[model samples]
Target: MTQTLVKAPFRADQVGSLLRPESLKKAKNEYKAGKITAEQLHEVERQEIKRAVDKQIEAGLQVVTEGEFGRDWWHSTFMEHLLGAEGYIPEQGYNFSNQETDPYDVRLVDKVAYNPNHPFFQQAKELVEIVGDRAVVKFTIPSPNQFFHPNIINGQYKDFEEFAPDIIQAYKETIHEFYRIGIRYLQLDDVYLAVIATADFPPEEKKYLAELAVRVVNGVLEGKPEDLTVTTHVCRGNYRSDYSFSGGYDTVAPIVFANEKVDGFFLEYDDERSGSFEPLKYIPKGGPRVVLGLVTSKTGQLEDKEAIKARVQEATKYVPLEQLCLSPQCGFASTHHGNILTEEEQWEKLRFVVETANEIWE
Candidate 1:
């Protein structure tokens, strides 16, 4: 009894960012070295994005993204583009499982506000023009909760109470701006929720953080247009195939599943670090549809088709099959560095999701 969704969170969706093609990577480096102009770099991005969209459709995906090809880091690019936020080289980079990332982070210099002229607006316009009507165009941004990261230097606001509303207003305005354009599918890529979910904290402290996470998310989502298919992709961190946190969703599931005001959830469940599906029971009937990230994007290895199907069947114990969809654990490239997998392998993985989903849901 699979229910067909005309909106997004498609049966076979993706977590947005894709592997950066070598040409675009080279162009980025050339621009950095002043060998190529910004205009030239953008032209290459446009070309690569077109090719990426075509491949996504060719792989049988109904939704297409620009592959987050226009920037260096997935979250920082969008965040720094805000009116009052700026990028800075931190003392250190984020610590992933066995490695450290490049030192890049965002900081607020003044009161944060949405910029109508943000580069993302132009990026979304180009994406819609390139995608045409063949597939839905999905635009992704970091969640407001992401701003609460300890690394992000906050210079304007004093406390959560003073800070939360402005972030909420900024996000609400940004969403409306996207809606004004042709984007109907918008996703907030959230790693903070997962960070708090698995962080070592006392029971009461964890509960407070989880509740605060929901409030920030819902505040940003308040009064969003009905036509916008807003979803949140929860990740435990996806950088160079390295992860940041590990633990079950057992503690935060009840809070997130029952409250976050979103159309669906792109949840990471590719490995044991994500824990069991028992927490999915907290998802009330008729609430957000769960797009299961059962396929791993960390490596080039393709999972057994039957094993993925079996995992989906296992998830059905808590959530009905009709309420479930499929995707990779995270994007192939959450950062411009991309993952350690070949481009061909990324497509192969996506094709597997489409093919496997067809068998189970179609």
Candidate 2:
């Protein structure tokens, strides 16, 4: 299939959050220990982000991200920065496969609202300046659905339905602010929907949760600009190469794939844990494109190029080849600890994605 290059969510896209460089990690530790000033730490972050952008372009990726260089946890960093939300240590950490994440989580302390002066705006502006037309700058944040996690302490609202409106309004304003600052491509890193799909809920309960997910997401996208491209990366969890959920998209495919108002779906298909491409049939014809995450970010091993292409071909059984793209299952570093992969291995995996995508789509 001959694919035409469009705006964001390029054929060889990524799920943001790259592995942090040693220098930046050291700076973070120093700042945490009060050995370095906030200004000094930010300086190092700026430098590292610039370098990360250069590497993305060099790796042949059309979309460039700051690698979420300034964040410790991809979701919490942005979530806690909201006007009415704050971070707090939970009683227990999130349990993943043989791993437990830090007990940190975000909660609403009052009515949620977008904070225009959120530091992410400045970070997006800096990324725009650094890229300078060389490639498209894509900004990523956690989905409003993420706030519905059971681990999150909901201090303001009685339930998700009541909490939905405030978060939806907050995200709507936030998206506009991103557009004002020159972010044309925005992706919501979502682990909630995927996690729910794996839950042992009754049929009606599952459907109810799925419908709520669509409502929350579509609400935020109610009146987004025509030019701004928004995509959602449905993740199952990514902490130190450990995952929290395991199941197919069967439960939520019909609801989310058919209703969520987004330009594309960056679905994870790196392993059997994500299930078959059969669920992808729920994606209506000419609807949002499906970016097939054929590469794995949890490990350093590079997949066979031909085998990856074969998997893409296999997915065409449900979705047309023209409507499909390729990327890693998730980000290399979803948190500050980073995945169990060397920096060189991470680049090699990305480069493989670019080369393989070109062979299949170009």
Candidate 1 achieves a global lDDT of 0.90
Runs of candidate 2 with Cα error greater than 4 angstroms are 1-3, 150-153
lDDT of 2 by residue, 248-290 (tens): 9998999999899899999999999999999999998888989
lDDT against the true structure, each candidate: 0.90, 0.90
Q: Cα deviation in Å at residue 92, candidate 2? A: 1.9
lDDT score for residue 121 of model 1: 94
| Minimal lDDT window, size 10, model 1 | 149-158
* lDDT by residue for model 1 (256-309), tens: 989888989988999899999999999888789899999999999999999999
**Model 2 TM-score relative to the real fold:** 0.98
Error of 2 at 93 (Å): 1.0
Native-to-model Cα distance after best TM-score fit, residue 243 in candidate 1, in Å: 0.8
lDDT of 2 at 64: 84
Off by over 4 Å in 1: 1-3
